[model samples]
Target: MTNPQLLWLRKNLFNTWYNSLLTIICIAFLIWLAKSIIIWTTTQAQWTVVQVNLRLFLVGRFPQSLYWRVWIVLAIASTLTAITWGVFSSKQHLTKRQIAVYTFIIAGFLMGLPGDLTSRSWLLLISILLAIGFGIGRKFPKIILPWLSLTWLLSFSLIIWLIGGGLGWQSVSTNSWNGLLLTLLMAAVSIVLSFPIGVLLALGRTSNLPIIRWFSILYIEIIRGLPLIGILFLAQVMLPLFLPVDLRLDRVVRAITGLVLFSAAYMAENVRGGLQAVWRGQVEAAKALGLNSLLVTILIILPQALRAVIPAIVGQFIGLFKDTSLLSLVGLVELTGISRSILAQPQFIGRYAEVYLFIGSIYWVFCYSMSLASRRLEKQISQ
Candidate 1:
């Protein structure tokens, strides 16, 4: 090989006077930025606050006794993750480096905590076990995927019960939720629960029936036209009043409800775009083959419509995840809110940069993962 690295450098960096100068300036800036980051993290940053409050960062003030239940939920999620990967990635074998990185990550959790086996450690162990579960799940009937989605739905319901305390469990109120737990809970719950609602709204908007289409259009427009924060405010202040005297809407539930409704309106629009992108020929062919209108829409149109909008749907999901931070504005302490609370504490009064950076990184990781997954799915669908 004729030194491909040097060739690339020559072509890209030294091709012109401006190019070489610009590259040198960028390199110098990057080196300076790297040094600053290293110095701040090693010597200036007060990491002890973060370490001490890690649990609060992860779960807020969720009772320590209930911590095990959250871990169990994580284990279930890990198993589901493994099963999904095994099913979808059967043709895409993991590289040795990929396997090693996964193993290292799983193993790192074993020693992440000070204890030999803490809740986090145990939860991480389930990830290792997930590989085994994936093998078993992948061998099941191909029809298991839908059932698996239902399983996840049930699992999510169970988690809500476990955390919020109903059905003979200790009654922890929704107000107690905070930190990353609250953020993930609100975002995940809204995304899952809003999907079906969004689909219905989308269908209604596209329906031949004038009343249904008009109503859907009105609702989607009203919700989308208003700011999300305003909706959250309406949900918080107005929801309880709308209920019977004996009923009360939990603050956490209100926040989630507002998010679901708001996001569903956006989701419905994304899905409508998908519906439009589906070819007219597909519907015509289905009808010609003796499929009824309902069958044609459901069997022939819906999948193509949905597949076309997967990227937009995932983008909405990322937006919804970021929107969870707004719950903090309404006085529900999610990850960002919790960080602000900690920063307001007398001892950490001036640590804005450190705390906000940590909060931002957490949000970035989740959003980035969804973004990357959407790209992968878009590729798969195109293929």
Candidate 2:
């Protein structure tokens, strides 16, 4: 290469390399300074008392007898996660950093630095099960499908057996269901239920039937117009009036119902956007082939629409996960609610900073993972 060209290349490299290096150094220094200040304030200056309460944070005031249910739920969630990972994009793998962080967090939970409030052994067992599930998902994707199906069947059967056989499984009231378990349960159930409802609503909104379209549109608009808190209140207050007098839904059920309805409205809009993205020509082509409208949608349009909207769907799921915290307003003890409860306790009084910070970190991790997964799926779909 000519010296002039070489000089130009050198200049560009110098600018890029020096700029990146400077940015990294600045960030590292800022982080170090922040850490130093925090250490000084917490330990040396005594600006804040650092009372580490890991157990109450993880499991809340969950009773010992029913502690196994929490672990069972975790195991079920892990299996579902592994199934989803395998089914959606088995070729995609977790990064080394992700694996390390997950392992470290689970280990920290098991160690229980402050005290053993919850069962560390159960947490550790669940962690191991999760790790095993992830390994199975990564290495043997084909086997995961059947395993997931079986697990789901067995789980439901167990629930039924508990209810039917009169095993006297000490029922943990929904009010007592607090902490991470409550958050996960609410988010998971809401997302699962909302997805199908959203798809149906989206389809209805776009349908040729005038009555169906109007009803769906009205429902979506009304729900979207109202704040979630209002809807939650409605669920708690007005929902029972609509139902039969004999059936009274619990507070958690009402909260879940409200969440599902609210989320589905937003999800419908997202799916409608995706549906609109389908080329008119493609729909026409399907019609020209004598396919019915349902077939055209299900066989031809819906697949393309969903693929184009996977990122949006994931975004909604993340939103729903965060919104689960809102259930606290209705007396549901999710993660944030549990954190607040902890802060109110005599032992952990005035430790809002630590407790809230910890809860925030947990939320960040889950939201971040969902975002990363969305980006990965986008890349895969593009290719």
Candidate 3:
């Protein structure tokens, strides 16, 4: 019998003399790189910096006694994620490879953090809830799908209320919100707010009215022209001058406002591209059917336009998420900012590589997950 692996190697890596030479050289370089990484990770790296400061990295100066609130929020998020996965991946079975990978990740986290039994128990419970939520979604997708949007909105409101702690609970100042918690909150709020604003801007830019179109174009162009850092600085410094002294905005709120303004411009351009991609024939067809302009736009044009630009829209979202790191520069302690603070400690003074590598891994996990979800959603929409 022909060896399939060998055949594949011959056909691909050894197809021509130059190809074979390039493949050999690439393999050598990769092997050397991998070996170096392994050696440094296993021998030279002191991961105590990461392990000891894990909580600080996750929540910054969040009160330890109030961690249960964070846990509840996490559980809710995990459950929602699982349900979404189940709905979209209904036809796909949980393969053994995927199961193994999930298990390995969970085990790695369990072994890594120096958390006590309570924390581990919370993690386990959240995982179990996620599984239960997935099962519910898979079993009743039709029933659940209709209410998913409403449920997500409610959950987001609940998350914000719990984190911010107002209207009955002891109010935690926004200044205390830091690290990954602040990062996620700012990113989520900005993403949610920016999308609708972007859609409106895109529509305005494409509108028949000269004034609206021109205003949209001017706003989009001016925002897109400025660097995000400059916008954030303006929000932090210049914004206060415009508002009354008594009406001080929280630093976190200012950062989120800046992010939304910056992201919405790019998002407007992305959505505009999608709007332009819609065929003129579709509009004509809808008009011929006696559909008014607004009806045609709402029912026919916008949906198709948004669907066509899903990838671009999601790409913009991913960029916005990563851009939260910039908040640290304006003095907000997001993930990257928190990592710098960690490195400033006496014991971890020289551990820049370890701290940054850990932070980078967190970023990769989130960015890759968003990219993966985008691909999955695109696949589902196509089907």
Candidate 4:
């Protein structure tokens, strides 16, 4: 190592005898842990359980003929994600380290996948679409940014229609929606629906009207007090009793509903904290400018409030995404649910470590992406 590098490390990590001893111990432990994990992954892990059942892990019982729809959904999501990245980031340039990391991740994914032409082709198509979308966003960001919200709303509807299939397309049963597809769908739907409800609840909680304030308080407190598992149970089982005898909501729909309701309560508290942080003077200034309450809140207060709580809101969203695993316990075959089914198979019965580690990695990827995006968005907003 360079003399400067060694000096810097010595100053930071070995400034004292105790510090040097602790650093050495930590390094030893990390090396041992890495060696053990690598040994197990290389020799003991039976990845065939994942490779053979990749489809089941991804889309579950969704019809093979309709796999095109899943590919389309992925392509659309990937493109939108790229566009969002371009919109938020000032520069499209990547550092060498960032480029290397991204390349390694992409290559690892492709190499790990089974050698299926169709899967590879779909992934390649999505990658191309993502690149194109990013370029368009970089070129025409002002034009695209204004319409981006409406575009996202429309795309979500289109995704649902494609997946669920109605209006001239053959109707696929909701039961067929399982694994990662169901997990993402439920998380997306819940997050989207819950945000507005949460905002409204926050507003109502702080409203001038007593009735509205009390109602919002009651709802938020009741929902917050209950366990998420209880809420899921109520949505899945007890919800049916409230409906007409002939009418029944789809299980997936119910699960999303439960998630939305549960998330909104916590979201309300986060928003309320943000709302409290907003200065009263700002609202008064907006009102003095002849703006109505609605205009003042929407134009002046809401933006600042939401900006203040971006991290909290994004953390809640990540929690909501991970919480979708609970749906497996309630009988919806989401990622965790599908894992149980895969494990139930005769050959893969004892492969719990392999199955769980795979899903755990998938969960980590999404949660970390959300966290990274949150940090970027926060930095952009702060600037």
Superior candidate under TM-score, 2 versus 3: 3
| Cα displacement (Å) at residue 359, model 4 | 0.1
Kindly report which residue stretches of model 1 are placed more than 4 angstroms away from their true locations once superposed: 95-97, 113-117, 120-124, 134-146
lDDT agreement of model 3 with the native: 0.89
Which window of ten consecutive residues has the lowest lDDT sum in model 3? 103-112
Q: List the residue pairs that clash in candidate 3.
A: none
Residues 1-383 of candidate 2 have per-residue lDDT tens digits of: 99999887566544587776876798899999999978955675421323454545566677756656655765676656755564556676678798779777866775564435455666666677766666666777676665665676567556434322345656555666678867876887788789989999999999989999999999999999999989999999999999999999988889989999999999999999999999999999999999999899999988999998998999999999999888888887789887777677686677666666678888999999899878866876686
Candidate 3, residue 271: Cα displacement in angstroms equals: 0.6
1 or 2, which is superior by TM-score?
1
Candidate models: Cα lDDT each: 0.84, 0.78, 0.89, 0.91
- Candidate 3 structure quality by residue, lDDT tens digits, 124-242: 88767766787787778888888998999899999999988999997787778889999899999999999999999999999999999999999999999999999999999998898
Task: Output the number of the lDDT-best candidate.
Answer: 4
TM-score of 2: 0.79
Please count the clashing residue pairs in each candidate, in the order shown: 0, 0, 0, 0
Q: Give the RMSD in angstroms, all C-alphas superposed, for model 2.
A: 5.2
- TM-scores of the candidates are 0.92, 0.79, 0.95, 0.95
Q: Give the per-residue Cα lDDT of candidate 2 at 334.
A: 81
Model 3 TM-score is 0.95
Better of 3 and 4 by lDDT: 4
User: Tens digits of per-residue lDDT for model 4 on 50-142?
Assistant: 999999999999999999999899889888988888787745466658745764676467545674788888877766676677667767777
